[model samples]
Target: MKFEIIQPGSYAMIKATLTQGEAIKAESGAMVAMHPNLDVEGKVDGGMFGALKRAVLTGESLFFQTLKANRGAGEVFIAPAVPGDVTILELNGANHFFLQKQSFLASDDAIAIEAVSQGFFKGLLSGEGMFIQKATGKGSLAISSFGSIYKISLAPGQQYIVDNSHLVAWAGTVTYDVQKASSGWFSSVTSGEGLVCKVNGPGDVWFQSRNPGAFGSWIRQFIPSKG
Candidate 1:
């Protein structure tokens, strides 16, 4: 299956095409447009949602969904139940809804919480932590990185260390610890643990390519360089 992210920033959308046997899950009214030959289904549950159950689609089911925040909710995350060719569309205004097939869980069991705000860098970091907790099964999620989106694998018996600045999202089942990276004596004296996030394996990790440091570098281009 192939995927393309159409918009990124406070609001994001992904446009994807599904070949035969591809599927994706969506909410009750999230479809902006879909293929003519695609089959659609509705979810019948309302339970606290994990990652996979959040989105759902059957084979070759063409559907589109939105992942924008509510009017006052600030930001929102759309985890459809079905997995397949998925596309994201940017919606206008604050209030928007879509039709989705709810067959996985009971409506009462579906997970619902106030949307998150992607306004600040720190807010994104916290969102990463929360997104992982909502992950289900062995599937890895592709999140938006500054330059591009990257994948994080959650393999057993292995550990991954990442800079907090670079982390986009992770699996909720994985445990994390704030550890210091060992630099030389002088380096260690000044930089402690380098502020790295040591993550246990059996889960995936996502990182952002461009960071605050990179942004600074880009902004510095206009400054006069002195030898």
Candidate 2:
């Protein structure tokens, strides 16, 4: 299977070419176009218990759509739910990363997506909820973000501060500490910088330029809401 990331930011698409019998598991409603020869089916990823874990903990829907090239070679197109950039990650031995909520787009069958708890403070104050998606096994995976994504590399004992809302994914080799952005609580609220994450990295961290939560809050003033 071969894949191309069409467009880089704002709006991106994943265009994949699959040889016979190649299959890709994708998020529901993400498929934009596909070849007729490919067979499409909806699946509850993992089993019943595993599906429950993903849905309840990770904020991801239990269902996923599978596209299988049953006939000859075929093409498939998939896009994210929002306007953003798309990133393709090749998974091999020792591949494991902390996936941001709702960021997973697609992957090969060999990959496993699970909801793993990240403990109390990270669960409560990290902007991301309790359980983040943990991707493992061997396969290719695609992730999406609401804005341009940047990769920050870290050496042992080095530290980086990231706004909680801007974090997308990170390598598991790193350690993270969450705290208020400012030492003074009054300054924290007034400065428009809230909680931030102190990532003690020996690995990489992927962050987004835009904060969707803050964007929605800013635009909601003009949009009508239920009383």
Candidate 3:
């Protein structure tokens, strides 16, 4: 199978080309279009129990859409629910990724996506909740962002501070601590950056240019309130 990110940057989508009998699994409702030769089916990956775990833990869709080139080779277009950028991560057997809620778009059938615990304190303080989606195995995994996605590569022992809200995904090898953005709570709040993740990395980190929470807050003011 071959994957290409179409219309990169804001308003991005994925165009996947599959060989005969090849299949791709995507978040439910992500398929925008497909060739006539392609067949689509809804499936609960890893069964009902796995689906439940993914939905209840990470807020992902309970079902996945599997598109196959059953009839022959074909192309399928998959898109995210929001208008933003889309990119593909190539996961070898040795590497994995932890994706933010709803960042997953599509992946080759060889990849496995699971909901994993991030520990109690990190879960609560990291702003990604108790569980995040982990992608493993060998395949191409497509991830979406609320805005443009930028990648930061860190050398071993290098550290960087990132606002929690801007994170899209990070390499599993990276370690981070969630803490106040400033030395003091009052200064942190006043600085407009409350909690930030101090990332110690030997890997890459992907961040979205826009924060969904901040965007929501900005739009809320324009919405007429109930009198």
Candidate 4:
């Protein structure tokens, strides 16, 4: 299968192309525009404001959207994200085809994972887990990041401990566990590996440029909170 990313690091539309019989997994609802002939489906749980929240928060231009094609090809996926902040992911096989970066959040009114997962049948299983959207065989995807992306790959018999503050994304097949750092929080905090997210086996891992909670602290210092 062949894939390409047309635009890098822009809030504007990003495009990709894919070949048949290939697969890509991502967070759903990243499409801003595409071919009219393509078959599409958007899945999300049936609940009060569940679908609406995804449309508003996840940075998806639309609520729980998808596209499919049996014989048609050469489709385009656009990022309809707001001008300042965008969240989208485009993948082809195990590689990232495209990504857009947006600024950090200024408030705690974050989007819920379960609402975003509604775009796919999987719906968010955990209140704190990440959301996923995937494509099987021949398609391009677009994603957004708050800053530049980082990568880590794990080998067989090896394990990785990543701070949730730095984690961006990882391969679908890999397993993740929240564990105590080998050298303790002090070591990790000082060494940039604090209280880790342990990952195993041949797959990629991503890390964010900054932490929201950490950022929040910085924001709070300027303005005291009420008890």
Which ten contiguous residues of candidate 4 have the minimum total lDDT? 100-109
- Model 3, 1-227: lDDT tens per residue? 99998999889999999999999999999999999999999989978998899999988888999999999999999999998999889899999999987799999987988999989998888777889899999989999999999989999999999898788899999888999999999999999999999988899999888988889999999999899
Error in Å for residue 162 of model 2: 0.6
TM-score of decoy 1? 0.40
Q: Best-fitting candidate, measured by lDDT?
A: 3
**After superposition, candidate 3 runs with Cα above 4 Å error:** none
TM-score of each: 0.40, 0.95, 0.97, 0.49
Model 4 agreement with the true structure over 89-137: per-residue lDDT tens digits: 3344444211111221111011122322322221232112334432222
- Please, what is the whole-model Cα lDDT of each candidate in the order they appear? 0.39, 0.87, 0.91, 0.43
Model 2 per-residue lDDT tens digits across residues 1-227: 77789988889999988999999889989999999989889888898888889989887888889999999889899999998898887777685888888789988877888889999888889987888988888878888998888889999999999998788888878879998889998998787887899999798888888999989988989998777
What ordering of candidates by lDDT runs from best to worst?
3, 2, 4, 1
Query: Where does candidate 1 have its weakest 10-residue lDDT segment?
Result: 99-108
Q: Is candidate 3 or candidate 4 better by TM-score?
A: 3
Task: Indicate the TM-score of model 3.
Answer: 0.97
| Candidate 4 overall lDDT versus native | 0.43
TM-score (C-alpha) between model 4 and the true structure? 0.49
List the candidates ranked by TM-score, beginning with the highest.
3, 2, 4, 1
Off by over 4 Å in 4: 1-7, 10-13, 16-62, 65-77, 80-138, 185-194, 220-227
